[model samples]
Target: MNLVERDEQESELERIWSECGAGKGSVVLLEGSGGSGKTELLHQAAERARRGGGLVLHAGCSPAESALPFGVLGQLFSSVPAVEGPLARLQAPNSPLAAEAAPHDPARGAVAIGPQLALLLNEVTATLLELSAAKPVFIGVDTVRHADAQSLACLLYLVRRTGAARVMAVLTDDTAAHRSPFRTELLDQPHTRRVPLAPLAEAEITALLARQLERDEAERLAGEFHTLSGGNLLLLRALLEDHLACGGVRKDGYGRAVL
Candidate 1:
């Protein structure tokens, strides 16, 4: 995608990424509808952090595995060699010894924190925080609405404790779906910044088309494309490709892409 109408959002992310390197941590939530480019914007931010010598840990969540305990958290830490011991402990299957170690809240009972979850959350947070002592750490999670409960808990714990450290967590949420309670809590924090990504305008659509076609042809097609796609980049790109592939026709390409 061309990133045609996201200059302001990109500038904001650059500022936040720079601040992360200066020992000021903040949470950035990329809120958008499907195909509004949240994931692309997130990758751009992560690349910026990486270029600044920041330790970038990235993860993408899946709805199919949302019930799997600590799935997203495990993905983030799995790449780090230093946290292997704690990561191994977390990756191991459920056992009675681990179950007995977690202290439950008296009023809430055993289901409140789950068995051994609190300990794992603390260990991961502590490890990441300690790592940030030497350099900036960037944690990016995409499609966070589908993150597992335990992973969300650990993320919330780490985010709440990031005030004084060089640790930044960038997350993308699909606004079309129901927002997770944990994700909502993250956005409510004072240091959290929300970047709401919107669909592209007609002019931006024209520009995108102009990338491949002539200016006159792009201008001529922009309105119909915009009307059909509602300015969604993903749909627009597919339509363009279909148009080109089908000898410049828009016969059922969008529907096929949607399918």
Candidate 2:
């Protein structure tokens, strides 16, 4: 997909990165429903970061590992240049920073997060600032709603102090999904922006199809797809693939579907 109806979203990310490169850090919350191209937009921003000689780190939050503390951060910086020392060691299972405990009292049940975790958090914050001073560092996460509590805590801590450093963090998740309790750290934080995505427009869908099909054929199918898909490109692509597999999408002399 050629980034239909997402110019503003992508441009916002660029603006943030440009500001970060100038020693003004920023954060962006990319909100969208499933298959709304949130991940694609992140990748696009990452490409720009890379081209600008900035370091790009990306992690995807998954249900299978959502229970693991600092799991998203581990995956994010595991291969990156900086933060391979204390921050890297903190991700290990045996590290004291990965401790887990739950008190009997529900009010005190904020266990698994203890003094050791505070040290790790400080280490992450310092490392980010130190690295950002040398080169722009862009951190992006997808499906952020599923991120573990520990990762979110460390990120919130970083967000507070990143305003003066050359760093930018981008987080995204399904717009229809309930907000994660962990995101409270990001709430009311300065320099934070939320971007919600809407479904593609009829013209955008037609242009998307025209990339492969002739204009007349693309316009004809776009009308049906716009209605059938409710402007959802993910569903439209799936339906299109199935239609092609069943030989129902064959073109006539005028390039319209034979049916």
Candidate 3:
């Protein structure tokens, strides 16, 4: 779904990109309850990054998936191709894999994976820096509160080390749930910005309906929608869909429902 009206949030994201995309490290925290549009906001930011010719890496944290080791890292690795230069840089001079590698040697693969993971992360950071060398790189994470402990640790490492590289890491989470340790850590760090998302205002809701429905129809339903949704965007959208399905019609001036 298109983000209805969130100029403030959009501007905040743009600001992060502008300030941090210079190959300098930056972190942006977008905290809100479920259905508050945080994920949509991140999606918008990712689009911005793509337009600027920057690579985008996306990972979502889930309770069930968190237990899987290297879940996030695995996702990241699969998204981007291997960085040969970075891998070479990571290999030790005396390492066996550094000497020669058989095509399908599992042992050699195991020996290389550890250092390669480190190098890969560094290369990812470098790639972000390279993309933002003239513009900015955008890294987006959703449902961060559900992120695995390992991913959280790596994120913390990124926050601490990313300043020299131009990368903006945007993390979103449902604030109503248990607070994320990563969120707390990011807040404590320097150069991190936090934005809390609340429900939409009545006028915004009105504008949204106007875009979705006829003016008169929107006007007739606006008040009732506001009453039903209390400006909550998710609830409002769901309620509207439900209303349409239930044969709810637009009311005329006298408040009579016209089928």
Candidate 4:
């Protein structure tokens, strides 16, 4: 879907992407509520980075695989051959970064992340930094709130050390979700920029409708559509689909579905 009322956000993202290509790495957090277009903006940003000659590594995180160690990391490097060297060892059976490799403090009887994890984090970070030496790298992860603990650690490490490299990491998270300490730390980084997204405005909704229907008809339905969808782009699109399919908005059909 085409973005509406997001020119400023796009411009900011373009600026960040340009700076990343200029060897000024930074982190971007797209924060928004559900159906607020965070994922769409993230994909658009990744496409922009890719078109700008950056090596784009994009992955989506979910609650289903949140417990799978290094799940997000695997998704990121699985398709990129350039960074496969370090990822090979990380994914190998019984590798140092394996789940069992987490250090157990026998004295304190608590699991402590010792040198093993640190080395692995540095190895992954080094791989990206090294790749950036040749070309800019863009790491885009969606729904970081659901990223596994280990992958989140790797991302956090990279975010802290990306200041001088030609690398940019863009992550999206639902503002309504619980903010983990790892996410908090990542957002606290000096170079991190937070972009908060809200639902579309009435005028933007009307503009969106105008793209699909005649201008007068779009204007006629904009108020009711906005009221039903509460300016949510996703819901608004569904309502539009219903209107197109049924020849009008039926409160018992898509209207009820959206509600």
Candidate 5:
């Protein structure tokens, strides 16, 4: 998307990068509608952190995996070095789901045992501290609203303890969905920032069309697509791809797209 009209969001992410490097870990909740480039911005920020010698961990939440305990957390830590043991112990012991859960998510049992939860939380804190002790760590989660309960709890726990560690937790979720109590609680945390990405303006869409087509065609497509996709970049790109694939480039003199 080339990050069109995302200056404020981009700047905040850059600030997060700087703060994470300075050992003042931060959490940023990026809120946006679909096609608003929330995930793309996070990916760019992760790339920046990686280029600056930070270890990057990413987890993508989905409905199918929401019921599994610690499912999202495992996706995050399993990629980092030497954290497998702790990740394996995330599921509650003696729970039926524990036996049936995948190997990566030992805490798959729905029921939570107090001691087991404590152990898992402690392990998470210890592992993150150790990982960030030597270098910066960037943890990014996309569609975090669907994150499993156990994982969300551990994330909230870790977030509360990140002040002195060299870590940055970047989470993205849609704004239109039913509000999650966890998100409301997360917003109240200290050292956390919520950045919202707004919809693109008509001119921004025009400029994007200008980048892809000639002057006359750009004007035509910009006007046509602003209506077609309502200034949504993702949808606009998809429409263009479809237009090209179906040989819809031939336009009338009045500049209407020929079907």
Candidate 6:
């Protein structure tokens, strides 16, 4: 499917590139309701960073991992090679203690792994700094509001340290449901920028539908789809799929329904 309405976000991403290119690493906190295209914007930014010869690392936060120390760090460790050595040194091979100390069961594992996890995360931060020295690094964290305390600590540490490092961090959070600690931390930092994603405008929504359907069909469906989804991209797409399945936008019909 074509990306119908991300021109403004694209421009912001380009502006971030210019800032980073000038040796200013920025943290962009993107806040919106669920299905509001925050993740899509991050994906676009990551793609752009990759094309510009920057390293991109993406991680998602889960409620199951909320108590696990370094849960988000572990997710990030699996992606970027720059931190492999430090993480390896921090974690042992097939150790029962390590397995038992997993982040998901932090209450049971915290006594055994808490201190080690903190030290490991510190090492991870240092490693990231080392990697950033060679080239710009882009880190995308999704659902930051659901992130664990330890993971949030690590993120805050990164923001403080990035003033001297070539790393740009992008985070997405559901603003309607929960507030993000990271967002507060970012706002205090002069280098960080917060971008709130609003619902797509009617014209943009029309353009989006047009990319998926012919002109007349797009015009007809766009209004209905916008009303149903409130211009939330994910819901809009789902509604479109439902409409298509119901033959609401047939190739050869103006107002025909299959059922």
Candidate order by lDDT, highest to lowest? Answer: 4, 1, 5, 2, 6, 3
Weakest lDDT window of 10 consecutive positions for candidate 2: 101-110
Tell me, by TM-score, which candidate is best: 4
- Stretches of candidate 5 above 4 Å error? 5-7, 92-115, 215-220, 242-259
lDDT of candidate 1 over 16-116, digit per residue (tens): 87887888899988988898888988898888878888899999999898767667877998888888887777667884323432324422222235446
Q: lDDT per residue, candidate 2, 1-259, as tens digits?
A: 3474577787778888988898888888888778788899988988889899998889999889967867887887887565677656776667666653222233322334567666766777887788888899999998887777667666676788888889898888787766444455575788888887788888888877777667897888887777766777676676567555764443332133222
Considering lDDT, which of the candidate structures 1 and 4 is the better prediction for this target? 4
**lDDT tens digits by residue: candidate 5, 87-140:** 665554654434333233324322233555666567768888998989899999
lDDT of 4 by residue, 57-166 (tens): 99999989976667899898887776677777777776767563332432222233457677766777787788899889888999987877767767776788988899
**Candidate 6 ranges with C-alpha deviation above 4 Å:** 79-82, 88-123, 249-259
- Give each prediction's root-mean-square deviation over alpha carbons: 3.8, 5.1, 8.9, 3.6, 5.7, 5.6
Candidate 3 on 172-194: residue-level lDDT in tens? 87778664455666789887878
The sequence of per-residue lDDT tens digits that candidate 6 reaches over residues 28-134 is 88888887888888888888889899888888888887755556766776777767775565444553334423444333212223565556656777888888778
- Quote the positional error of residue 254 for candidate 6 in Å: 20
Least well predicted 10-residue stretch by lDDT in candidate 4: 103-112
* Worst ten in a row by lDDT for model 5: 102-111
- Superior candidate under lDDT, 5 versus 6: 5
Comparing candidate 1 with candidate 3, which one achieves the higher lDDT?
A: 1
Name the lDDT value of residue 73 in candidate 3: 45
RMSD of 5: 5.7
List candidate 4 stretches off by more than 4 Å: 94-96, 99-112
* Model 3, position 136: C-alpha lDDT score: 55
Between the candidate structures 3 and 4, which one is better when assessed by lDDT?
4
- Report the number of the highest-lDDT candidate: 4
Scored by CA lDDT, what does every candidate get? 0.79, 0.74, 0.66, 0.79, 0.76, 0.71
